[model samples]
Target: MLLDKDGILQDVIPPRPPLQSLDSLPGSLAQKVYASLKQAILSLAFRPGERMRKSEICEELGVSRSPVTEAMTRLASEGLVDIVPQAGTYVTRFSMAEIHEGAFLREALELAAIETVATSITEEQLVLLRRNLRIQEALVRDEDIAGFYEMDAQMHELILSFTGYRRLAFLAETSWVHVNRARRLNLPSPGRMQATLAEHKAIIAALEARDPHAAREATRHHLRQLIKFLEPLVHERPELFANH
Candidate 1:
């Protein structure tokens, strides 16, 4: 893997094989299996550090052993789950250090992406971004945490996508797969979520004015907010990091 200056993966010389790509139409057994497991892990239905039995997963998901195996393999590759030899598979546990590192790395990449995008973002792109922010604000007010999170992900993805850095976007996305649960929890906190929307408004203002420096700062501030939001949880539940 080639890393960028910000320490994000830029490219994989021998790219990892693609996992099951289920569409809105219909999906293969493996794809369906992967989707189900991914959701359960994200929603905390399969709690952190919980052991996962292949047989149990197969029975619960109503799939065969092969699809469960494939899903577990894919989730393991993404760092969402772990496969311990001879013991059992387990959902990856949260760690204070890993959480901080992820937030820091994401901060750097997003700041860079914002700066890059601000320099070239068009009026049309600005319109679309503002529209996203509006929807996000409404969703946040409705306490629609999940919907707001999806829009938040889309907002960041849009910035990277429009900036013409698909490789960097791909790397950032993979990293997000590991930390999305924490990110989702961050949005439900009152003060943190309010600050998030304010930051989004500031970012939009900077982008609209074509101020690259302000846009970068806004992005950095937004990402750093997660560190403070998650601090209490990690401190109270120190056991979460024992295995890490």
Candidate 2:
């Protein structure tokens, strides 16, 4: 806790997202099961390294053994779960090595997207982006870290959408499955959520100026901040990491 303007000490705890219902989820049975598990895992509702009881999940989602089996297989492929033959299914633990690799790949893709959008973005797109930023700012104020996180993903996907490359967003999401889950740890750090908003604004400012170099720089700087913010977790919260 830090002193406020009036010198009063205050408690500062970050709120976690609640677990979402698995009922009535849309898609094919397997697809719906996959989406539900993915969201829970990504939001840290299913804690990293915690055992996944397939029977419990099947009963909760009202799904059969086959759909649950298919979802577990797919999640394992995505690095979201580990299937231990004798032990149990478990949420994958954070690995700094994997996170670094994911960051490198994302930076390469986003820099290219930034340059593309800087030149080609239309006014309608800017309006959508600005609206997103407004919501991000409010989330930061509310200290609604989970809400802000979803908005953050939306803004990135929106920028990629502006590039008119239909497959780029899918590529980015699929490629960084581990990094996406690990990012849940970084945002709630002291001042990090607000700092993210500021960085996002800088990117938008550069985009509005129609300056590719500046926009690319903004995107690079924003992506690099992830590692900086996450570095402390390796030492401070060792249980969050694999092989700790």
Candidate 3:
């Protein structure tokens, strides 16, 4: 096998990368760095309230300071981090109110989209969704946390795509980054993982049946599960989140 100068495998049937809403991002230094860092944060690679040092990040990512700075700034603007004067940047903390707001907003918007697509879902879209669900189930069964999370993100994206609203999909994705950190925290529990998989199955069934109310209810139910999980975290660990 051919090897690059760094001596790592150039090609070894590269493993499929985990899923995230940022997967379809455009090509650019800023976008690349942003997606990378966003995924890291969502996957809990960077802990909540953890300080982010620009110099260290620059070296670690093998990129210049500008792109990393730009990425961090964008993340900060998204409420994923706090940049303070005379203090330093820190990963944003989780807040119960914000979590509730995110769930309510996502439920409203996504339910509307699901309703719109209930009758309009094409055969191809349904097929792809089935494939995604299969992958999601397999990942969950294997306890492949990263793969499960990725499939979950993609399933949401797929539903939005079927609604034929790129702008809505983009907005939905931006909203996901906030919830993702919380999800990463909550998902390690076996009970939570099992419930999540069950919820996904319920959603898939509702969508397949082309039942608008059922689809909407399924979506709302899943998000409510997250609310239950995050409320305690918010109360138990105020240090992990900013002012709510």
Candidate 4:
């Protein structure tokens, strides 16, 4: 990893990592294609509004157009891509309206989950959360924003898991597709990753203290920060967003 004069990691993450190997992936051909494409899109490998040429994808995957189109169709259905009639397909852009709705849904689910967890979290679960935070701190120091994001997500899921409701995590994740894509775009901002780490620590502390009120407040603030961070991006990067 290269570092600048201040010893900060420079360009640590690529614009996109290499494409996923389909043969190594589990599932049917179409499913594998869909999974690969979705991973690329969510990870920002395929940026918003970027054209996805069928021929290029076919060449890259060494597959026919059928499966690629099939995968794209699936992505479009999920609002991850747009399928134009004659103009070829492009990744879906962000809109604050959609982002806010997704945030609202997530906060509603997570506030309740954290409240339940605060009252019932065991020592073992608390230890797991602390351990997760340690890794997140390390990732931040290393400037591994992608790794830190994964750990950040795990911390949330761990809280939901502690709630003893098997489906809440799935419900929160599946319902927040738009938010997830937009949320990641904000992580690379200077000092933002460290700020987020502090927020997570506050949440874990509230959980450790078994204070449901504190937990709810902490969770709410943490979730809202993503929206706050994203607000400026809409104007700065107008091409990456749309009213729809």
Provide the overall lDDT of each model, using Cα atoms, as 2-decimal numbers.
Answer: 0.74, 0.84, 0.76, 0.86
lDDT of 2 by residue, 1-244 (tens): 1223343333443333443566557778788888888898987778778888888887777768898889999999988899999898999988999999998988899999999999998999999999999999999889888799999999999999999899999988876777888777777567778789999999999999999999999999998988886777687667768888
Clashing pairs in 4: none
Q: Please give the distance, in angstroms, between residue 81's alpha carbon in candidate 4 and its true position after superposition.
A: 0.4
The weakest ten consecutive residues by lDDT in model 2 span 1-10
Candidate 3's TM-score: 0.84
Assess every candidate by TM-score.
0.82, 0.89, 0.84, 0.91
| Full-model lDDT, candidate 4 | 0.86
The weakest ten consecutive residues by lDDT in model 1 span 10-19
Q: What tens-digit string does per-residue lDDT give for candidate 4 at 75-140?
A: 999999999999999999887888899999999999989998899999999999999999998999
RMSD of 1: 10.0
Deviation in angstroms for 31 in model 4?
Answer: 1.2
Model 1 Cα lDDT, one tens digit per residue, 1-244 = 1223343432223422232234431578787888877877775557678787888776665667998899899999878898999999998888666676666677777888889888999989988999999998898788676687778788888888887876887878666664666665556555555677788889889999889999988888777777776677665555444453
Per-model RMSD to reference: 10.0, 4.2, 8.8, 3.5
**Model 1 segments beyond 4 Å from truth?**
1-27
Give the Å shift of residue 179 in candidate 4: 1.0
Model 4 misplacement above 4 A: 1-16
Instruction: Order the numbered candidates by lDDT, best leading.
Output: 4, 2, 3, 1
Lowest summed lDDT across 10 adjacent residues in model 4 is found at 1-10
lDDT of 3: 0.76
